[model samples]
Target: MAAIPAPLSHTVAAIDAAYVAAARNGDSLGVSMSQVIHPCDRALFYQFRWCAAPEPATGQRQRIFETGNVYERRLLDMLRMIGCDVFEIDETTGKQFRVELAGGHIRGKMDAVATGLPEAPETPHVVETKSANDKSFKAIVKGPVRETKPEHHAQLQLYMHAEGLRRGLYLVVNKNTDEIHAERVEYDPAFCLAIIARIERIVALDAPPARLHDDPTKKGAVECMFCSARAVV
Candidate 1:
């Protein structure tokens, strides 16, 4: 006789449980470069300290993250197809290009470094990849990533600075339309220095810094609304 199959709910629960188990442990010994640009100082502190038990992403959220990873690989392939010399791994380290600062308290990994682009074939540029939903994609397409997505712009700047590169390529994929947008970003030394100093200050602090805002629901507090440390802060 054929065996019985599990119920849909049970199957989904099992999958979600696996994702939760596979999630990165919330514990951190230092501040991640990814969080260096966060607008809220206290939120970054809380994350660095793991003050509140970090909640693992929901099953749906985990799937969404995986989807972004899938697209990242595709983006790398497309760059190679266009004759760009893409280096996803560092030969020296035999791993992804990594940046660490502030006595290793701040760290990050870049997506890749590419050379031989049509615009500036001679210059090596840091490559950053992203995937966006419809609304976010539309905002990016409107132009000026520095304004529409300041965090992403800051991230690329940090990557370029760490890699000693003067230029970066920001490639974003629109999930809804399958459209890709590419932009060339120039490194800003002043911005990099400012943020680095900011990271060092935050890492050296003994307690959480001042909250960006008192009311999480107030106008322009959108970031606060979703912050994990909202209650504690």
Candidate 2:
């Protein structure tokens, strides 16, 4: 019998092969993998990713609203003032930068990613912003001080991981209060490695994970609220 390949080696090779095939076919490797691992989830993920970006359908409406709203505007201006280069990722472009996850997959577009600023004597900051209703915004602000939400942390971590950054900055605003708070966060190599491992597990799974919840409740809230899955789920 042939010896089995190591798990890491197998996964890396799978990813590489998938990417090669996708490139040759002029398709997205991430999208191709999504078809293999979780077709339903990928469809939803694709929608949410684009909705958050600059799109013709929205006609830059999202940015307009964000700038018009007091709190959001302030946060946006502040981010820009800090020299953050804001950009959007459409669904098509997003698929090219996919990362696999356990029992499923995870992908993101950098809302506003900045680099080339002089590195601080201290760790650099990776900032993420969110706009939410009054009640939910307050709840998040008051929630147990756990650095930032793990999911947001994960999001920023992925950005940082991709950009080779070590530190992060987070700005969360309350639409009602027009208040903006900032926090500094450091990178956790362990957490990133765990996320990568989870992605590997997701890809290796025989079936997709359960459909994600689409409510504002704790467990159900994070991934789905802003996801395209909400529409169909």
Candidate 3:
């Protein structure tokens, strides 16, 4: 038999759809570090400089995102289970570590602020977790994170710089094998400054910046097929 279907925007009842609707509506908020390191500068600019937002994430995409949250929590437990000290929850307000930039136009939360891990032993490091399928896991292991996914690498650097941490412990789990890959990321002041400048420029712009790629008709580019800001380009 086929597996049960995840709820769709139209098919679900009001009670069932409420949470999903809230999650979708939340995307209408500000930018995050995830977009900072994207190869397409114009896409980032368009997103922050008053261009229209994309369609709400699809049900499958939402489920995949939700699954990543579950994996993050599980990884946190594994770290604490192995005798590491984790400070993901604050005792006072019971919220995770959050940092805002450009007066809260951009923000990102730490997966966990941890210490006493076997890898980084004694330093309080920003802990970022990720789960990827077999192929992407292998690629991440085979190359430096800055090379594999500049976005993740840049986000880590920003987290470390903003949080006053010198380094970070980047963690990734292979979804297919449950295997883990760990990398230590050091803060790069030059890179962080550049990213901050880029963000400021985008926010100050009255019109969308130039497109990173030419018109879709100019070159049969693949990114245009998936771009939400294409119309604004």
Give the best candidate by TM-score: 1
lDDT of 2 by residue, 1-233 (tens): 99987567677666556544443222222322222223244443443233233222332444445454455346657766767554333356663234433322444445454443344534445556666667866766764323425566667676666557787666687666767656656677777776566555554555445665434456735655554444543
- Per-residue lDDT over 35-54 for candidate 1, one digit per residue giving the tens place of the 0 to 100 score: 77888888878887777777
After superposition on all C-alphas, the RMSD of every candidate to the true structure, in Å, is 4.3, 17.7, 4.3
Q: How accurate is candidate 1 locally (lDDT)?
A: 0.85
Cα lDDT for residue 206, model 2? 52
Model 2: residue 145 alpha-carbon error in angstroms: 6.6
lDDT for 139 in candidate 1 is: 92
The parts of candidate 3 lying over 4 Å away from their true place are: 1-19, 27-29, 218-220
For model 2, the local distance difference test gives 0.51
Candidate 2 structure, TM-score to reference? 0.49
Q: Can you give the lDDT of residue 204 in candidate 3?
A: 77
Cα displacement (Å) at residue 92, model 1: 3.3
Candidate 2 residue 57 C-alpha distance from true site, Å: 12
- TM-score of each predicted structure versus truth: 0.89, 0.49, 0.85
